[model samples]
Target: MKNYFIVVEGLDGSGKTTAINTITKILNNNGIKDIILTREPGGTPIAEKLRKLIKYNIKGDEITNKTELLMLYAARVQLIEKVIKPALEKGKWVIGDRHDLSSQAYQSGGRNINQKLITYLSNMVIGKFKPTLTLYLDLPPKIGLKRILSRRKIDRIEKEQLSFFVRTRARYLEIASTDSSIITIDANQNLKQVQHEIYKILNQWLKIYK
Candidate 1:
């Protein structure tokens, strides 16, 4: 059987990292031997380097939407080649922190880039290997922004205004609504409650995978 490709997505600071980590530990404890937790724009060596360059502001030149979109696909290509495909071939669970939906959200919704262009570019780079199960941690844009602000300096994407995040979120919901594979979970709940919801989703997915 092909291994599962599970992608967790949301606006920045939706407790994605914590949820991912908790899922990792839970899967390990459950004796899911071949589970691998990885993320986009930084999974492989080359992609990680590119991630830093794209996210961090340069001294003078700005990272435009087109360049940002291209770089994300570039990283995704390397990740698919070096990490995602190989691991699934070896029959391991690949839990991704983010994936192509992020491109759709940030580049298209936030940056006002063209969706068709982004889709075409992503397909050329990563092909049709979309996520089998996408867990969208849903939280209000204001809440996410506040959480993000408490953590680190704002990157180009992070610095985007409240209006941008709202659109991104609306787009996420719109897409997920039409897709059964993508599951939306409330992220504004407390951390433990959020983790519980995740565990519930994983349990349901495991039934299909098993």
Candidate 2:
């Protein structure tokens, strides 16, 4: 079977996890075989450890943005080699919850790190292995924040000031504008409506693109 790498990206509370679950079930019902759903920063063992460090804000006391970027790449490098690439090689449909694009949006956009440098670093680390398609669940940061707050405990990144999240979300939109592979899906709608839109996109992917 041909390989498919699908990525789902959005700010917190954009319903990414729910979308993935729904997509998985829908795909299975459609008899789409060889699907593997995964998330970044925690796909492999080593990256999961790094994911804990970054999310828990364990290194916050002295963590510079540069260090944060490096640590993220460190986790990414390992995941691409250990999880992503291997799955693709086996002709499995790999669905990523978040990927390098998250780094660009959060680190470069939220932290105001250099974009040229960020691009260089991303290329250096990721090379030609970008996700074939990404579903960008777009919604207002305030709404997203509210959803996140009601759903679960906040992590280090989540504990950041409101200003940071607002900027980060803008960055996600900004990057989505420049990438053809990214399909922006309206996320402000009710859950069923959002799922309907996602289902439409998935149907297109499976029928036309596949």
TM-score of candidate 2 versus the correct structure, residues matched by position = 0.95
lDDT of 2 by residue, 39-150 (tens): 8778888888888888876543856789889989999889888888898988787888999999889998899999888899989988877988899999888888898889
lDDT of 1 by residue, 1-210 (tens): 446788899998898898888777767776776887788789888999999989885889888779888888889889988988899988898889999999888788888898899888877877788888898999999999899888777786788789999989988888889989899999999998999988888877777775
- Each prediction's whole-model lDDT (CA): 0.86, 0.86
Which residue pairs clash in candidate 1?
none
Q: Report the poorest 10 consecutive residues by lDDT, candidate 2.
A: 55-64
Judged by whole-model lDDT over C-alpha atoms, candidate 1 comes out at 0.86
TM-score of each: 0.94, 0.95
Q: Please give the TM-score that candidate 1 achieves against the real structure.
A: 0.94
Clashing pairs in 2: none
